[model samples]
Target: MSEVRTIGILGGGQLGRMLSVAASRLGLRCHIYEPGANPPAAEVAHACTTASYEDEAALRAFARSVDVITYEFENIPTSALDLLEDLRPIRPGREALRVSQDRLTEKSFLRDLGLATAPFADVTDAASMTVALDGIGTPAILKTRRLGYDGKGQARLSTPADAEAARAAMNGAPAILEGFVDFSREISVIAARNADGDVACFDPGENLHDNGILRRTTVPAGIPGPMRMDAVLIASKILNALDYVGVLGVELFVTPGGLVVNEIAPRVHNSGHWTQNGCVVDQFEQHIRAVAGWPLGDGARHADVVMENLIGEDMERVPELARRPDTALHLYGKAETRAGRKMGHANIVTAKSS
Candidate 1:
């Protein structure tokens, strides 16, 4: 309720770093609570606490230091939320996390909401896998129920013969079978809802992923006029369903029939990076504004923008990108480079078509 507020963020990655930067711009400060050493976000945050979420003392102290709390990533352990949520508010709240953290639950939640998603079935063991495979059929993907992202923890089944190998990939954890969908293109909507029930959605962005990690996002996604409106409405439906208070990322498949929900992220998403150059209010600042209880900003796009992620050795091209007048580079301050790592991104802006 004040001009100056403190926001505590969970997870210390690039999202946190950008969120902290936006918070600082708005005269708000950020405290980062991360268990990892040399976290990217810790470098830019006003304060950094390196402690395990299991430590109630550390969790409470982190909660006490900030006026409000949010997170850069999902996969936050339930135990940690149980400790901090009592002390301070968690924007987007636990309901969003609960549904998103588990693939099966998230799919069911979307289906129950009358949203279209890939056909899915639960699998906890070899027997269950057989049962699920029999029903959902071959050429499906087997994914762990929890904690899988960016091409990890997934097994592709081309035929029923590949079942055991797929089941073993779970490493004894619960899993789900999602029937493949033939989609024209993959797109995502990044939307924000503040505490006052106000909802604003950025223009949808078409996304391209390289080996499961997002490689690029382009605005004015090729979804025709009517489908784009449906995408926005689907995102808004989710935000309102959660009574969410912050930015949420909704990934969708533009299929022959309609838009099929892929998944939801309860924070600023990489797909929204194009907004930095396209919109008056970028996803990071929009998220910060919502978590800070401030009114939402303009989500209108002023330009056509394509955001390209620099994964690992792709950073080698930064110098070239920096020289381009229409390109804006946002590099994550990380010291090391390795394969599959997200090093930075570039936003290319152009005048909108008449």
Candidate 2:
């Protein structure tokens, strides 16, 4: 057994909540630092710090109280992390956060590493959009440079006439225009890298989306043999490039030509949530092992799985889902359910033939 240490998580959302539960199973305690009271993670953590990221005194206190630090989300302000890093070690480190924070920088960085990404150009104004459109053409996506997720902060331009509309919709934020990818399907690989330079990746999962939010994810993505290997290779490449020391989610588009990276999530991802029932070591537990200097777990799947997101009102079917023997229900303890909010998720597992 490895030495157990108290882990400090920077966010108090559902991801942090799940991570805290996983940490407890390994004899480690988790302290959640969040600005608001009653965050989901707070309920299960050893302690909770209610202070804004700008509170240097609180940040210092929180950092001093933990062995090592990690974050549940990537949108954390860089300055806040810098303050905590001064007091304790932050895994998956600042470089990964910086690169994943900005869409333009992320795409450029991936391209520089000889990775395939959709054709893209920077956009700060109408003229820049016009120029980018001229190069990348229409039917492209215009996305904000920072703080975009779950299909937010993005606009799709189907024609030249939509360029002005797209620019206006972004409200002058620095953005990127990406040429549309004609892909057959979308998939993601959830992988973990440890401080000792070890990496373990789960099987690729096929994904389906509705109105830009992920609706369902099925494992054994049903792609050709080479495509499965290609997906895992792409994810490993991103983890190695970042020198990442935690679980990372790599989203990919399976295009006619080949696999193309769409985005990177620096923490446990929604796509991998099915592992909770399908695999012995779920992404949450795997992440805790990586960040705590413990040996990484085997990521092999023992069952075929399908995970569905319960968006807002869809959570009403929880009672029904929970009654199914093969289904596992996970609900984020949120106060209210608004449209587009992820209220919970359900995973259906089926044992595979040996």
C-alpha lDDT score of every prediction, in listed order: 0.93, 0.91
**Model 1 lDDT tens row, 37-123:** 989998889999999889899999999999888999899989999889999988879999999999999999999999999989999
lDDT of 2 by residue, 1-354 (tens): 555489999999899999999999999999999998789899899999999999989999999999999999898987888888888889888989999999988998899888899999999887887899999998899999999988889999999899988988899899999998899999999999999989999999999998889999998897988898888888888889999999999999998899999989899999999999888999999999999999999999999999999999997898899899999888889898988989889999887733
**All candidates: TM-score:** 0.98, 0.97
**Off by more than 4 A, model 1:** 1-4
Best by TM-score: 1
lDDT of 1: 0.93
Q: After superposing candidate 2, which stretches have Cα over 4 Å from the reference? A: 1-4
Cα-lDDT of candidate 2: 0.91
